[model samples]
Target: MKDTPRFAPDDRPSGGWGSLKAVAVSMFREEAPISTAHALLKQNKPGGFACVSCAWAKPAKPHAAEFCENGAKATAWELTDKRLPARFFETHTVSELQTWSDHDLEAGGRLTVPLRWDAGLDRYVEVSWEEAFAAIGAELRALQAEQAESVVFYASGRASLETSYMYQLLARLYGNNNLPDSSNMCHESTSVGLKQSLGVPVGTVTLDDFEHCDAVFFFGQNPGVNSPRMLHQLQDARRRGVPIVSFNPLRERGLVSFANPQSPLEMLTPAQTAISTQYLQVKNGGDIAAITGLCKWLIEGDDAALQSGARRLLDAAFIAEHTQGFEDFAAFVRRTEWAEIERESGLDRASLESAAATFAAAKSVICVYGMGLTQHRKGVLNVQMLTNLLLLGGHIGREGAGICPVRGHSNVQGQRTVGITEKPELAPLDRLAELYGFEPPRKKGLNTVEACEGVLDGSVRAFIGLGGNFVRAVPDTQRIEAAWQKLRLTVHIATKLNHSHLLPGEVSYLLPCLGRIEIDRQAGGAQTVSVEDSTGFMHASDGVAEPAEDTLRSEAAIVASIAQATLAPNPKVPWSQWVGDYALVRDAIEATWPEIFGDFNRRFRAPGGFQRPIPARHREWKTDSGKAHFATPADLRTDPDTPEPDADTLRLMTVRSDDQFNTTVYSLDDRFRGIYGTRMVLLMNAADIARLGLAEGAIVTAETAVNDGFHRAVAGLRVTTYDIPAGCAAGYFPECNPLMPLAHHAEGSKVPAAKAIPIRLRATKPA
Candidate 1:
């Protein structure tokens, strides 16, 4: 890979020959062309495994080739034939491995057995499963006996719902609510914001809603790279003449247009379908201002219509019957100055009015968003403002309109649904007390940000990860990696070796686990685990491929074993029995959350699975007042506490490249962005580049603009001119995560504000 990226303008539509070529390259690189091809056919099929990529909902009527380009890469990456035996670790010291890139570390291959860190040798040595489990169990028990809060169990969204349930149960059974998962870092703001407004934490829109909606509004989401499968739905909606309006800082190629690789007509003719009919380049952290502008335009238009005795623009009936706080919300919008909105949003009033016209003309609309709207200081407010825009037209609970927060992981939503949260109120404590014969923890626990703080402060002594590279995913990477070594014990149950594995604790163990694509067999026959999609659809995923290694254990089995070893002689939990038959785990889940998972085993077996009930979908608000409430933003500024940038300062947002998933870089190239061979690059507007006296391709350094007393910066980043807001910049995540301070996060959700970090660039001489 080159130190500097090769740049070119990629005008080709997303997901055509480029996508097919990328998929082929991924398969070839993994050296499993035939097996990967077979896996692709089975992906997202009714009887096949779910794609271990984005949580985009699978269509009710499945297509022959349901998986997308990135999905294929994820599957091939998982099913790679490469193996990392004990000898490989023996040859590499921990210090030596720490110098490797994240991609190089994970690409080394699947872990073949349990390994324990040998402090004396400064390397990892193979250990028996029994010994590893016993040691981990003893360490956890010791921690629990000392202080349950001293230990933290972190889970990734990749874990199955069954496994997640057992993992959370294990934590609660040990008498601590310190159960933080991947959602805390991504969509916790959505969960927090939507719950307060719509009274439901999950999205209200169903897959079928796309077909009925007249217009689709996209805010800060790039589906083509993040959730490629969604392009099919967008393409279908576009073909049906639905107008799509997008508001994002970057004019993402996926939102501009897409070509379906599966469509013979498109692939053969190289034809493309337009995605966003209107694109508004909102400034970073300006989503709230933009959304508030829309609401203001609509509300004022309705007032003028009433004066002229024209048809009412707002939904008077819905507001009166099913909502509260409308008068206050309307007053707030009416009083908000248009000039402030324009300046902050980086959009003229005409664009917002035009967007409002499109939105008001449509009988129904769907508002879709991603982390861009939910990873700010006021991320919750940003989401609530979008909800406010949807509420003006009575979009919520309608057949064709609602809010959709596109989740990243395959089962991140499911992990939260199955009780993998730090909040005690979200868990079914009453049922757990009755079933397990023990009082569950009632105190709130640490989230991702707080967990990092605990580790840094030496309050957290042990760390257990079910599946994820925690150290690579979190902010303040250098600090967290160093603090992680101070832990008394660290156990990672994973399918492959990642950077997090190299950051060993005092008594660290790496337990190899089965990937979702691989069959999970137990004392019973082959078992199936369920996952919930972004749309709250619960479906079973049957692993069609064989395990990479025979000694690997299922995540459920590993969690069960850990629980059994830690809390033995407790008959009520039945950890061994549940692990033997996953159906037993489902039974416990059903009994615990009967309202959502009622008839779990039976419903999971049904074709296409069942949709979990979303009360807001039926106008049944679950708020304190039992009515949907419009939330008034404290101010138009999304980051009220953040100081305004000077002439050289810019709001920098960390993003995922086309060739990468969360913290998992498949390659150094970001094809869609026209970046190749390097991840160390900064995307800046041409205007800003000239204003800062920096030329395109010039080496520069981005320093945090905040006065946090800590000098945070990333150097050796090549500047690339792009069509972005003048005062905003873009860079890939994990690399840019270092610029984000641990103290900078959403006020309520605690999600790191990676989307809008205040930064200033300085020219650097090339080495």
Candidate 2:
């Protein structure tokens, strides 16, 4: 390791020099100026790049330093100075780049020029925009003419709403709606779960409601690392003396303590504030048991009311008026013996009782979750169960209360908001068709999972990705790569290079676009793009930096340009003007959802941005029954899709390192976990290691046993001791991504079981 001084992350304000330097260096793939990353970080225009890191929501408040350590690294990765000049490819073949590490490939820098794969040389050769576009158009046209079911369009969450909106429109216009969005791989389960329970696949919390909550229940999420921007809100709640309980498998640093780099004095002392009052390390899949135990402890428990005859318990009135299936849910809970619950949760009755006590004592509480709570076979049931818990506590409607699902991307929710969905309702499409003066496809398009299958079977031929590394993001990497190879054409509008770019077809093109921080000036004087955060809060993002390269264009412009080139005649929506001036696009958005985007441009002018309509604030339940309900799963151990593993094997999962985003590699090291210089490692508990007869740092080979022609396996991974459950193992994604069989995804949602890989581990050079 180099003994160079790298900027360290702090909780207090010193212009975030450390994080800025780290981010800027990696982004441009160059060292223009160390301080450039820091100065640009605070710039309002610079803050809009969707955080370039995790899918964590960007707050509506436009925080002074809205970004975090991981977020900064994400931005730097995009803003990197490293450029893949023509010669860089001359030195390395496609085969060579394929063998390169994730970090090494990323460090090769931004793809400044477009290139097409040279089949004979087994490498990529530089190509002009005209030729590249013509080749891509020809392939797509051929596929369309054949009425090909073998073609799919994969959309990434990293894409701007404008890009996504245009991509889907282009596909549908060309007579195919095989749009497989990023949600297929990540939060599709959340949508399935929430939709089953609440009708809408979104959270119901308003930020203002946090002011009235008495306690917060954080489940299956790591806020400190995954959503560091949310820490400020939690800290505010803590200052107000509200109890914050965290239930996660790993005890992360972000939840323990955070030194706010934006604080005026905290940086001087390097002082850190403890965040969570209680950190309950629940075992994996233990969420079901833990939640059940908490609910049981609250309902049929020893403690009934507070001292002096006050009713400080479950809200029976609310449960009766605003919910259903309590009797069935309670009876089901009764069937779950405490012994089994304790065994699965790894928590004794006392711990369960204690956690319930926190919720029981509070009048109003908020439950916040992420993909962790919903990425299971019973993910839908899991969501309903959480809703039941909240409703039972009368924690809907007022301040400091309601359900908060921290969205990962700045506009993932927005993408859905603008109709970039697979299982989209007929009403939205009808409305879109009516407004656009074109016939929309009534046929159900393939989702993320279905898209991969279509590709592998030769039914899906061509692919046009608006950002996202679909090939890398999808599970069963070998299968997806093979499927991608069968495609007639592939096009990606990206900021940086990833494995997805290498998933070539007969024809392919990589178009680098301007980053969120860069100034996007076209025919218009300036441009502002709309993005919806996790909270359903939409805001305008203006670019802050000069364009890295002239060839680079705004996502809006590129989408419009492609649309104009591909679609015959002119579009009715003034695609060209919308590209240069996104306000007109916001106007179009406002026309679609008036209740949410009212005064689309005017209200966004406010310093602290506005929020979208939250029906939950009024205790409004949109389900058919008009009440929050509970669902009892038919069976707990009957996940046939992701069947239980053999005794000798463990259920493995793939997770991102603290420093890494979805499939993008910012740094090879994960400083927080003490992992460095490598990602080819697995994290498991010491007891699991000992039981498997393996010493620390032992090399092991792990491969998924799912028999579906899916080679979700990787050989020779180093083992590292971590604070995890006995039967569980975790390795960084895209590396361990090989273990997640595409067919073994969650049942109802079909989201790749990235968090639930059934695998066997064998020690190499066993001690």
- Give the best candidate by TM-score: 1
Candidate 1 residue 181 C-alpha distance from true site, Å: 0.9
Candidate achieving the largest lDDT: 1
**lDDT tens digits, residue span 112-203, model 1:** 99999999999999999999999989998888889999989999998999999999989999988898988999999999999999889999
Measured against the true structure, the TM-scores of the candidates, in listed sequence, are 0.99, 0.92
- Candidate 2 C-alpha error for residue 161, in Å: 2.5
Q: Write the per-residue lDDT of candidate 2 for residues 681-741, one digit (tens) a residue.
A: 8888888888888888788999776777645568778888888877878888888776776
Which residue segments of model 2 deviate by more than 4 Å? 1-30, 38-50, 54-63, 302-312, 570-573, 638-646, 707-711
Give the Å error, residue 391, model 1. 0.9
TM-score of 2: 0.92
For candidate 1, the 10 contiguous residues with the lowest summed lDDT are 1-10
